[model samples]
Target: MDDSGLVSFFRVESCGLYRIRQKADGEFISDGFPEISKSLFDWLSDRSVLNTIPWDPKEHTRRDKVYCKDVHFDSYTGDYLFVLWFANSEAAGEVGEVGEVGGIDLNSKVGDTNNDSEKIDAKNSTGKELTIGKAMYYWFIPSLKLVASINFKHSKTDIEAFTTYIKKWFDNKNKHPNKT
Candidate 1:
């Protein structure tokens, strides 16, 4: 958590799209795609109403479609951790083409709640949106207010090896605290 009592919050969509946010002066730091942002806002609005109304299967299905995975936080490092999975690039052909990267159609126009179509322009992205053929592991540090680290794994074995290394490092840190 930061000095303002604001902790970094993250949300990851099923297609590996993600956004990080922190409440500061009534504004949010968001990097989600336009379609994703609309979907998330709609889901949140519906969720609030669902609490007052009876359970509905359609709403449950809608909720599932919006969020398919969980984002975890590493307490030791104060890092918000998550993984982004991508399709095999060799099978997909190229990276820049729509649906060839992270399954997101970059060229598609996303509409707002008022039904106005809004294109996802370059200004909305941070240049790291097109992650292809790799599983990306991210660590966002709240104190730094930025993504401190990102590791890309090309195979299951690579992911496992990195996971083991992270666990070992955390264990070692636990065993030996720095003496000031």
Candidate 2:
């Protein structure tokens, strides 16, 4: 699929900044525009940015209302990067409304090592029935060269999952460049 088609399938709300630079001799030069920067990359990678959607001057910050939707291509690295942004809070909870999103409570009985569907379902505020044991296929998006796919559920996605996705992307890019 092309870029537009991937965005449509993922139901992306906004596109994040992308930077493509090349090293000539020793100095790095921007490919074309200068909108994307290392700082923007750092900001996008930061979890705090995911929870900090702008709001009215008086309202309290609401992390529950926002979450990431999908992975986007990193032009320079040729790997898909997780980009988080705002979406309808209710829609965020519905299955298939968005892509590759899930929720979890770190303090819950579910340990970090296991994605216990029963524990996660029981802990989820949405109280939706668990679609456990279903094979999630989006883990690798070949069209976008994405090594990791996301599972969208009604729970807040865990930070470990995001980190794992990044690591997988790097490993795949290095070990199987064409596959990613």
Candidate 3:
């Protein structure tokens, strides 16, 4: 959970730049991190569950919900970075808010009322309407007061691919301790 170690790992493993924050002090550990889109940032920051939970450092958290349309960072590429907020243990037992999509919940109200229509209509690369649901994975390392997440399109394939990639990266790192 060392800040430098986390930064180094993400530098090598992430498809895009990752964000890391010191949970205890609200200090950002990521250098030159771009601002998350306003509506998306407000939506996540408003989640009371994220602030109330007593996160266990040993447990990794994953949540699937109808969160938002793809969130674009303030960069030239307009890259989408799924916002993975810290989750509470209680969230697993509770139901999410209902959304436009059937059987999925919007979870929270987006901040910008003017953009509600735009945010609700999530689409895929093919321009087909895709579900707004996303699977977010969060790691809360209390020992280091750090919470880190890397998010992408939600799918079984994407999850497996990320896992496999991380495993291989770790395997290589373990095999060559002094390489970095």
Candidate 4:
């Protein structure tokens, strides 16, 4: 799979300041789900395959590159597929640009997190005990690195789960210099 294929499979939306077509706001996405649309949600609900995406733990070692030796490569969809987050993405206001891009979320604001699937202590059943914040991901494309900076107000566990998944998928494996 290539970059286009990754976007389609992952269904990544547009970059900052713009909303992608048929996107389900974070609220629409179930508690554990990263992001999905109403259609996807319905489909998954029907099949009862909500949490059945097959991905096992993978081990990866860092393969030094000629240009960016220190930068570690993340998950790959195929032999050449790469999910890159650039170092420049760490700079403020960088993701605020326009035009079609991959894996970028900027100026994200929190709306709601009460999707019913999220578990909360009944003592705080008023629901104030539970909340959600803006989750963001960016690819420092120029730097060929992917950076995710998602913050949460009360959904700490969800945030942790997401970050852990990303790190495991990328950090666990190293790119092979000589590909077959």
lDDT of 1 at 96: 37
lDDT of 3 by residue, 1-180 (tens): 322211111222222123445665333333222221222333344443212122322352342222332233434443334433322223332323333221122333332232222223224142423233234443323223333454433221234433432333333322322222
Off-target runs (Cα >4 Å) in candidate 1 are 1-70, 88-133, 152-180
Q: After superposing candidate 3 on the true structure, give the runs of residues whose Cα lies further than 4 Å from its correct spot.
A: 1-9, 13-69, 76-80, 84-180
What C-alpha lDDT, on a 0 to 100 scale, does residue 148 get in candidate 4? 36
lDDT of candidate 4 over 54-117, digit per residue (tens): 1231322232110010112223421111111221222233222332111222111111122222
Ranking by TM-score: 2, 1, 3, 4
Error of 3 at 93 (Å): 1.6
Candidate 4 wrongly placed segments (more than 4 Å): 1-49, 52-144, 157-180
Work out the TM-score per prediction.
Answer: 0.25, 0.29, 0.20, 0.20
List all candidate RMSDs to the true structure: 20.6, 13.3, 16.4, 19.9
- Judge candidate 3 at residue 142 and give its lDDT: 27
Question: What TM-score does candidate 3 get on C-alpha atoms?
Answer: 0.20
Candidate 2 contains a number of clashing pairs equal to 9
